[model samples]
Target: MSALTETDPTGAGFSPEGLARIAPWMDRLVDEGRLAGLSVTVARRGRVAFARACGQADLARATPFTLDTVTRIYSMTKPLTSVAVMQLYEQGLFQLDDPVSRVLPEFAEMRVAVGGNRAKLETEPARRAITVRDLLTHTAGLTYGFMEATLVDAQYREHGVDYLAREGTLAEMTARVAKLPLLAQPGSAWNYSVATDVLGQFVAALSGRPFADYLREAVIGPLGMIDTDFFVRPELMPRFCATYAYDRARQLRLFDDSVETAFAKPPAIASGGGGLVSTAADYQRFCRMILNRGTLDGTRLLGRKTVELMLSNHLPGDLAAMGTPRFAETSYTGIGFGLGFSVMLDPARAQILGTPGEVAWGGLASTAFWIDPAEDLSVVLMTQLVPSSALPIRRELRVLTYAALAD
Candidate 1:
């Protein structure tokens, strides 16, 4: 809805000729029917160097995508939820190493799965309780049912451990998650899991406010991310893009209708993991806050040191060293999981054009964002496709975006 296409990026340290390539690239993607609709915004040194949208928000309606087009950001919500929890950490509400059970009694004592099938599970006492940092780092041994690679993941499916089930509140579902056998011992490994959803419950219990409310007041509101939320309000529905998936024929097909989407209303459980709909404009601001060391427009949601800690690598080594055999939101090579984002350790090792210490993440929908501290850059690239692995757009855009840098 806002006319935000970049008017001039030369002043922002980008070559005009290089920036010119983006429009045709987007046009090619749209014209070839690779994307139904897409929007991208790139900012460096707090100035937008390139911002544009192409394709249709709704193939049926021919709605144009724009900066305000709302998208299901999915796992991108993890960073925001992680930031919210760290706000309490800054208050000394709890130590990062403190057991999660200190706030949610459901995880007080837990068992780890050594081996077994989905029909029966073998377990032993966990080496230690899952700590708050474990949840933040995704080392608490939880597994997403969707991974379907291990018995614990199957158990998650069997017991409905997903936040999408709409069975109860964040607290109620997280308690169920605690009852399940952990895929591994706490701090023993990293697996993409429902750790962030549990972190949502932890925030609610310690802050004495609902997870969604606290997230808004402490993080989203302060950043002025008005259009970023777990649900899209009625007034904003018109700009909400329809989600898509590749059919067996490899053609785009409607996945989630914009008008009938569950995100059109509040969710039963606030999924801090893979929830929240946002626009390129709103998410860019979120990335900018992180790029700006936890402050945006004079609103400080977290201390600078806390953000530094978050952006720093937390794993013992790169993700490939973790030996996690599960489908993840990020590549497990030359990348390390930070508190809330994937820290790029080496561009050469990762085989991607990126700077070390770049914090980034993507969603179930082929949406992605990254904040490169070395380059003073933040970018949000949005499209409505499901299963991000469906395309190599993120990597392609990264090359295009970084190539335009003149300073």
Candidate 2:
């Protein structure tokens, strides 16, 4: 395990004193029992300036967390899945505006719920076929079963839309989803749903290989993200971190043990939406690729213009207004959804300390990463906590990180 230490040289554009505040803040969180274990890393101009680890990876076993601790990065997998799809796009296999039905015909006859209760549902024809861009921007009408506030969301749970059956596959799961009514019309509004999972199926169909295989061969292999994958290998199990949730008394308690984790083996469906385990160092390589304009150590996964299009705002006027639901972890006032990330449009409107054009995303377990091209900066925060909305740690980390910039 790598100890918390400053790795920057004299000219790295980060104040050592300012960078020093980061570990202490994390220590405070662990001291307060808000987090079981955590690790953080910051880099600028392609060089690491700060790296640290704190708390116990397994409080019950007294295992110390380290920089190489593997964690379930959940939705952070979306960005990587998006990159894979775009790689096929670069091959001229399909256009962004192309209808998803063109590739996955199962979605051809999809319907929208007009106005109905969970007991009785009404339906209407979709305005148009859902496009690849709609899935990328989350304008598609798909809904996650876990988001159970709405009637459609409730229907998803009732129908077992998210069940990762031992014998089921992405193609079969998508086919099941097609039989359900959509939560909204295509391109009508922004809803965080199973759109990315659907994109995974589309990728498999277009690339002539399984989604995970293509992801490993095309993205993870080239980036040298040795520890990032859909499942943790047996040899690396000792370094995997356990997950936690706050008890009724708001105390940290064991939720999932690393030894018996679901990620111990691969699932039937490769959930490109929220199914990945990664390390701080491994994810940093992915972020650095984005920060370096689609290239890392001479390995180019995407073209410069393609990356620019991805980082730019894709939402229309006030479409981001639809993103501020009760469960949203981000401030929607000045943020917009891009191809595969959240783009900061105006930091002032967001009421947070950040630069415009910055792109970022977080996992369900409090893990997060951001790339600021303007500042040539990248930061990765790793931890294991269920119901990520439990704290504003991501915002807190942002303030601490930007405050330490020497330039």
Candidate 3:
């Protein structure tokens, strides 16, 4: 939609030639109907190296994508939610291993779904309470709204606890979620779940402020991320890109937004798990803070130690529970889960050619971004497609980004 495909006037590590190298790959994706639109940005040493928009925001509609386009970032909200909790962590309000129930009474008597079926939920006192750290690392036995092909999905649907819906505040949603059975015991395994949302609730309860309010005061406002929020403003709504899904026929389908859905702005439910809408520039400021070790420009968001804690791995030997059984040593090497982001425990295990101790994550909209401390590189690739978890295209982009490095 917006092509500065020409060389950078600033020549900040990225040349126009670097962008041209990826043009064919991006063009190929457009031609093959693989993506509706893409907004790509690469930064090195805290400066924007390259930023570009290509193709239509909706491949099916031919609506051209632009720099201001907004796409649902889905799970990309995790890192931000994680940061919010860490702000509390810096205050010494709670320790990483503190039992979650200590702060939120509802989680005190939590139970697990013993029979693997939501209907078979049997009450059993967990050997240990889910800890604040557990929520951040996703090891708190929480489960996504959709887990198995069985009763778990049914239970989620019946509860009306729409995670993607923008209805209730984080606390309200947490109260509803607490009534459900946990999928596993705390600290025993990894599960991609609503734990971070719960963490957001914890943030509100501890801070005595709404989650969004706390985030804005503690992080967003401090960092100057003015464009990000749970709900897009009336004026900014025009920049919101149309959402699309790739069908079996490899065609893009325009998906209608549902008011009842979480994306429409809930009553108070600010899902720390997946309720954020961000721009490349907005998120780059965040990555820059991480790259700067808890500070950006001259302001400090967290201490250096706190930032390290977030980027370090906290996983035990429960890869299967974490849903990473297929991960090999090369890609997962020294890689582990930290408070809110993926810690690169083993650079080789990460499969991508990144620095050791690099931390990164992506959104479900095919938005993948990583902050590589070793290389002093942070890259973000944003698009409007759902379920962007597929590897080849993302992997190719990562490789290409690395290849473009001047070294």
Answer with 1 or 3, whichever has the higher TM-score: 1
lDDT of 3 by residue, 152-225 (tens): 44566678767666455566678888888776788777667788888888888999998878887888778877
Model 1, residue 96: displacement in angstroms? Answer: 0.6
Candidate 1 to native Cα RMSD, angstroms:
1.5
**Evaluation by lDDT, superior candidate among 1 and 3:** 1
lDDT of 1 by residue, 263-296 (tens): 8888888899987898888888888888888888
Q: Give the distance in Å from residue 152's predicted Cα in candidate 3 to where it truly belongs.
A: 4.0
- Tens digits of per-residue lDDT for model 2 on 186-231? 9888888889999999999999999989999999999989998888
RMSD of each: 1.5, 1.8, 3.6
Cα lDDT for residue 402, model 3?
Answer: 73
Model 2, which residues run further than 4 Å from truth? 1-5, 163-167
- Can you give the TM-score per candidate against the true fold? 0.97, 0.97, 0.89
- Residue pairs in clash, model 1: none
Instruction: Candidate 3: list runs displaced more than 4 Å.
Output: 1-19, 59-62, 116-119, 149-153, 166-169, 257-267, 317-334
Worst 10 residues of 3 by lDDT: 1-10
Candidate 1 Cα errors over 4 Å, as ranges: 1-7
